[model samples]
Target: MHSRSLLSPLARAALLLALLLATAPAMAWGRLGHRLVAQLAWDGMTPAARAAALDLLQDEPDPSLAGVANWADELRANDPGLGRRSASWHYVNLAEDGCHYDVARDCPRGNCVVAAIEAQAAILADPARPREDRVKALKFVVHFVGDVHQPLHAGFAHDKGGNTVQVNLDGRGSNLHALWDSGLLEQAGRDEAQWLEHLRGLPLRQGAGLGPSDWAEASCRIVRSPGFYPGRAKIDEEYGLQWSATASRQLRLGGEHLARVLNGALGG
Candidate 1:
């Protein structure tokens, strides 16, 4: 029998909830979006930052930033222990707090993406830390930056970042969270390079003056916008046309933010 079968009913339920929380927000941008973010960050990074990043990642299975861009999401299968510990690092719940991040209320004990990015950036910047540890931190920073830009990732927590909101896409069953994660991008029918080209053409209006918390607040604001949430449950082509641009903008912003973070941490 499975080891979980040995637990009492209450214990089983608690375990299930924990598992759910861990996996729920982790699906921020699908692999394609994540890779695109990594590539964009790479393109924007300074020479010193790129060299440092490559040095830290030298011993990893895939040594490039884009190569490890989705590492955090694959942690459940590749490294279960770290996956459970860092799951909450993917998102913050600020919907109830006026889209503002109050550390004591929304991020108890530094568990959300905003704090996670700050913490990982610190580790990556600390030359005294072990090379292996800093490498992992770099991966987390790349991923969490992308996660924080997903509008629904910082949306109302009652809906668990819209994971609980059911919707239909071309008659297929799906959820709001899933739609933002990859649906809109996939509907564009572009490959990774094509998507990157499309994203690059959009004018980036966000500045480097903002930090992680500010980014989360911006995402939350997007969620609170009128018509941001579809009036109907059907995700038609019109719906995709209206929202995919928003998703693209977020991807562009996420990439720029990551580049700046890495430049600060790794660039001399």
Candidate 2:
């Protein structure tokens, strides 16, 4: 019933292509989301974890948790070679096999986000690592923890983590990936103070009951939910509202999980 029905095959295909994007889903949480997680982690860090982390952060421009929130993405420009080398570490593609994650098949070579979290935690935990190296490791561990909790970051591989699913989120022309990355958070209209308050209000965890694959599976389930697609580009404000809780929950989870990771590795 759409205009595409009247166009030639090539024209229809091209028209559809024009509306899609194939980029890696923008880093989860964009800048704001990551900062929220960092602040939460910092607020709850043990004295030992705080000391070890800040020691590595000696010369950072902004010597606070939120300060380095976007460091991993910034490295894409600040240190292009290393950034390229670690590009795949930000997300793991979950597709074809349904909600279950098969580590060997889905995360071969230890390149996926779950592995990135483990690897960076190791570097942060190892006292012998150079201070600068530990700093970089700390940044990625913080960033990837945020990444794994972004629903689309762990979404279907077929759609490039929903990057290919074109949509309009609350009057903004954007895709599903962009919507989750920050659009919904932005739409919430909360300031950093409010977000931090919300984060603190969430129940503290013992880091039990969930891990990277569980986190990934949780996101995959959200992306594949019947209510999520909403005719793609036709998804509007009401649809976006339905999932605001999900965004909040994921952001809170990111903050909580990151706190545990940092404390476990550096808390001493």
List the pairs of residues colliding in candidate 2: none
lDDT of 1: 0.82
| Number of the predicted model whose TM-score against the real structure is largest | 1
Error of 2 at 146 (Å): 0.5
lDDT tens readout by residue for model 2, 79-116: 99999989988888775578788889888999889889
Candidate 2 wrongly placed segments (more than 4 Å)? 1-25, 169-172, 205-209
Q: Name the top lDDT candidate.
A: 1
Residues 80-161, candidate 1, lDDT per residue (tens digit)?
A: 9999999999999888788988988888899999999999999999999998889999999999999999998788989999
Name model 1 segments beyond 4 Å from true: 1-26
Q: Which pairs of residues collide in candidate 1?
A: none
Worst 10 residues of 1 by lDDT: 1-10
The count of residue-pair clashes in candidate 1 stands at 0
**Stretch of 10 with least lDDT, candidate 2:** 1-10
